[model samples]
Target: MWGGCWPAGPLRRSAFTRRLSVPISAPEALLTVRGLEAGYGKIGVLHGVDLHIAAGEVVTLLGPNGAGKTSLLRALSGLLPWSGGSARFGGLELRGVGPREAAQAGLVHVIEGHRVFTQISVTDNLLLAGYDLPRAERMARVEEALSFFPEIAAKRHEKGGALSGGQQQMLAVAQGLVRRPRLLMLDEPSAGLSPVLVDRVLNVVRELQARGTAVLLVEQLIEKALGAADRVYALAQGRIVLEAATSEADLPRRLERAYFGDDAVSPLEA
Candidate 1:
């Protein structure tokens, strides 16, 4: 079923593809990073990475495995501390900010994998996301988030372990939505999901964009990622190699060259 959703053929354009003709300028960007670097003890992963995401824009980050995509997201969301450089979200400095502070500042990271607690009820899991809120506001936020995923809303009382893999993924995303973040960083939401379920998850990016929420997505599905984004950034060896508007022509060829270096042959020429 997963194979059918993402086949080795020409790319399938997503129904939610953006039609923007011009890229967002840096001055209006919602998130900005300059010369950012981070890694686990004694090892460096990201090297002088510079990137920006405009308000309400969907920007997809693509690269082969070990491209530091996950590391970049972790650094931005305060999961991994930045060792050098600087980052600013909504004009506030990000250094020394922790995960909870990042979320409270309207920058939420929905980490890869279906990470919900199996023993907890679906609604309870969402409630935990808003645990710091007042009683009434927390309940209201939970209801607002459930509105986006009727599949899980119908199973609100069920333990997270009882849901299928797809539903669990939805619940994880819903957990992020409970905060109503201004900028959501999704680290491969499509991982391990069937194509149908992948589409269901990507569709939420569209809904979020329509409501003026910006997203920085790191995904493995090239076609789907490009389809859902207004711009694309390719990271290789812990650095950004390519940045282009999704509407540009010959993107596959450009992406190939970016991934394999300038010497790579375009599919058309080959």
Candidate 2:
């Protein structure tokens, strides 16, 4: 049977910090998914997804709009119904779990679009994310999240709606960290932000990885995603058409292949 909640213990720590003792050895896989399928109603979006991420790896999922990237993430986070497949994190089955249970399972999905409570104070919004956690631990995690985004920290007393778009986006991410999840899944984090704010958000993601949190990021900025991720998966029409590594030097060609297949001809050719 699957575990009842997302994390089995208190404020689940990032697995990245645990392997520092054996620096020479490779980190173990923290999450794995196979043959995953899900959708809204009868229209299937994800058609047998397969993926895995090591304890400290930054794996980005790239795709055009409506290619099922968000659907796949929702399935992983238990926000959507799964038709079939296995999702395992740290050896636990996540087939029928709910989103809250997934969060406790150390797999936190920071949804796209700022979903902060409009009427609530910034601190209060964060408090809601960790209401299940003990007070002291919750406080600690909130502080840690605030440290990553000084803009949010300064506006902790302000209502969520009062913050700028960039600041609200920062809060959305901060709210996800109170549980101290091992795998942080982000969707279109750079959407609607200025280039400078986008860099700030990406920097936070890098810091999270540095602190040993595995990241499954869905970003549109090809260069930024490639720069931050060790491996990249590009989904086209509900399928992963290509995957490549940053060290491969032929990354441009790889991306081209993923975006437009080799057989695709230029307009002039037609």
Candidate 3:
């Protein structure tokens, strides 16, 4: 049984004032999934999937569209009700959990399309995301989140709707960060951004990981997501067909084959 993310105490007081060096120590899995199942409106989209993420690790979910990659993220984050599975993160089972409960447990999901409160100032959006925090700590985290995206720091007071597309995406991530999550799941974060901005956003992601925040990334940009992953899982036809360490030499070809052509491509290709 997993213990859930925290020890039932206040979050450890910490500040990400600057980019920290990537820790050399490898992390053990902090999230574990077995036989997970979830779907939309009674139609199942994820079928008996299993995956895991280690503390401070970057795990990427990849596959062609309609492969149910987003479904897995939603299921894990408690957005879609799931069935017949055990998803234990930091010692808590998540299958029947609600989104607010999940977030309070330190699993924060930044959904697809750069969702934000368009009418609110960037700072206000961040503040709202940190609503459960005490006043002083919430303000500190808002500043900390803003620090990661200096390009948008100057625009913190501006209405979210007024920022350019790329900036809003950055703000979406900052909103998630404001919650001080132990596991941050992002879906299609690079959508609608230039190559340069895409790189910029991913860099901040890497920085967050470096700062010891676990990340589960769902991305359509194959190369970019795989490049940042320490491990990768390919979801297809609502099932996981491949799982491999990012260091695997033949992973690119393997993923290309598993993701593109027909068939299981070897059940759970190691």
Candidate 4:
């Protein structure tokens, strides 16, 4: 389900696309979802969804609120039960994988709402995620993540609730990073941040990709998603309505229609 390298925007290139195209040297797809159907208590929010992400790629799922974006993230994280389809990570099927199992397999999901441990200090929040690793390795990752988010380390002893909204989001992402996940899933990462903070967070995402971590982002910020993702899958009414390389010339037009119906709404490409 991969192809040759194409320009990201008038001739930019992506290692992920180039690697996915090679049948022999290709790395196993980091994540694949086929006919995925999931919802809350049989409500059937997602219908026959299909998506894939290769190792070291950034794929964004963009849609309006209630379009089942959050549901899909929950299902992928094993928080919600999937009625049908298969989610496979590195050739291992996720039929019976719980959240713990998913994390163990290198898929770390960072949900929105900044669900950090409010009672714990910021440092403890990050350390908790790396508890499974040996002391040296965990400490090394801690240092690395802190470099990406020096604010957290500076406020390490502060309670989670004491931080600002942006700080909390940073902590959430930093926590996920400590896990050293192969596939990082973010749900509405920029949902409530200020414009500057949103940009900062996206920069952090780019850094993760530069370090070879695959990112699957669920974002309502249309422009941010397009700017950050190598490719995109747009969903409407619980189904995939559009899939395109982020670099396509008609991407903005198509995305507007998918996101705003027949209205003249336009998504600004950040």
Candidate 5:
């Protein structure tokens, strides 16, 4: 689906590159993470995760429940603090960063579950996303974001509660687009929706890519996720177990092995 092509730039050495011990220059990646670790209060969830996302590229993170997919996104977006390791976004370090700072720095996270303020107007919901901006700029950004979802844009004046579940999800994504983030991280965007609605939502990823906005997608629909991303990373037991281009042969089989620890030999090992 990725057409076996990478974005035009000097590619950086990623977790997969390190696995092969390939020599490369320092990373110029839009987002880079090395040996990242995080957890809730006393329960650790992530361990030494390494990843990188290039500008204008779509990367999907796939894993089963409890594989730390959500936790990893939270850590990168500053919703959860990292206990160890390092991350940099657009040349800014992520240590001690909060959610607001992350968004301001163009690293926006659209959390799962289609969370929204049901009592407010759809425009108000988007306005709140850009509240920190000047009034005119904020309004203009809201209009720009709404353009991505005409379904909700038509209901701009209606209360958020009036929208269906799928529309709410679209609004949630529009909220992230308000910031015009350099990198947008989505967590399980297709959790609950009809097949058509699911396709509608995933189609937005292609639109974003066309606009040169990078995306980190965490999805349950394996086929859809792979279809939208240029690269895939499989996380199992809080660590990245597989990283490969979507165009590679036998990827589904390799992913299966990575997830279940099957004893079959992998191309990565061949």
Candidate 6:
């Protein structure tokens, strides 16, 4: 996020990390997934999966492509039906739940593509997400979400499709924020973003955690993910292969070693 091109080495501490006085630690699970299995008909993506995200924590899911990271989010958000196991967000079980029900229950999934009402204005897009609320409360929520994404706030009157990709991505997150999620699941939130905008968006993730929203992130930017993660779970071939605290002395090394059986593969190379 500095002025120059992104550094080639592993991600270093940011000013955001230093600003916090206390370290975030693991808490009781706000979301609990056990033996989760999901896939298209006759195909399976998650295999006996087990994962948890504590209240107000940021947990990142990492892995190479086709590792079922997106599938995990989809399953949790109730976009895909589950074959076995349960995912509990607070007291509600996700199995058999619909996408709108999941969101209403405070489980918001901002999927990878940053889907929005392209033909509508940015403000209208956010308003659509809060349609269940009264107009007065809806406007308040919209304003609060805009505060987190000032770029979109500046273009509030423009069509959602007119914004650049990064701005649209921000608007997608802002839409989710208006829901005041108990657990926010993001799939590749930084994909295709410029380095600076990537930094900005990830900063919002960290900030959201500080403000008491638990986050479940699936990211390809391993270093950036680790830098902001409280705990991390790495998936490979549809199963969780590695789990560690972000504070581990050699996290990237251990993650790669767990994935490839070679300590030589730094996350920077991924």
Report the C-alpha lDDT of model 1 over 77-172, residue by residue, as the tens digit. 899988899989997899779999999999999999999999999999999999999989999999998998899999999999999999999999
Query: Candidate 5, residues 1-270: lDDT per residue as tens digits?
Result: 222211122212232223322212234689988999999988889989989998999999986677789999999988898899999998789977999999999999999897999999999999999999999999999999999899999999999999999999999999999999999999988877788988998899999999999999998777788889998887766778778888887786766455433453332333
Q: After superposition, which runs of candidate 6 have C-alpha atoms over 4 Å from their true positions? A: 1-26
Backbone clash pairs for candidate 2 read 6-104, 6-105, 7-104, 7-105, 16-212
Lowest summed lDDT over 10 consecutive residues: which window, candidate 5?
3-12
Residues 141-247 of candidate 3 have per-residue lDDT tens digits of 99999999998899989999999999999999999999888999999888898989999988987998888999999876667787888988866667776778878
The weakest ten consecutive residues by lDDT in model 6 span 12-21
What TM-score, computed on C-alpha atoms, does each candidate reach? Answer: 0.89, 0.86, 0.85, 0.85, 0.88, 0.89
- Better by TM-score, candidate 6 or 2: 6
Per-prediction CA RMSD (Å): 6.3, 11.3, 12.1, 8.3, 7.2, 7.3
Pairs with backbone N, CA or C atoms under 3 Å apart (clashes), candidate 4: none
**Backbone clash numbers for all candidates listed:** 0, 5, 6, 0, 0, 0
TM-score between model 4 and native: 0.85
TM-score of 2: 0.86
What does candidate 2's lDDT look like per residue over 1-270, in tens digits? 111101112211231112111112225779878888889999999877777789978998876667788998999898999998898889779889999888998999999999899999999999889999889888888898899999889999999999999999999999988878899999988888988998999998899899999999998776777778888776765666666666676666545444554453221122
Q: Over 4 Å off in model 2, which ranges?
A: 1-27, 263-270
| Candidate scoring better on lDDT of 2 and 5 | 5
- What lDDT does each candidate get? 0.84, 0.79, 0.79, 0.78, 0.83, 0.83
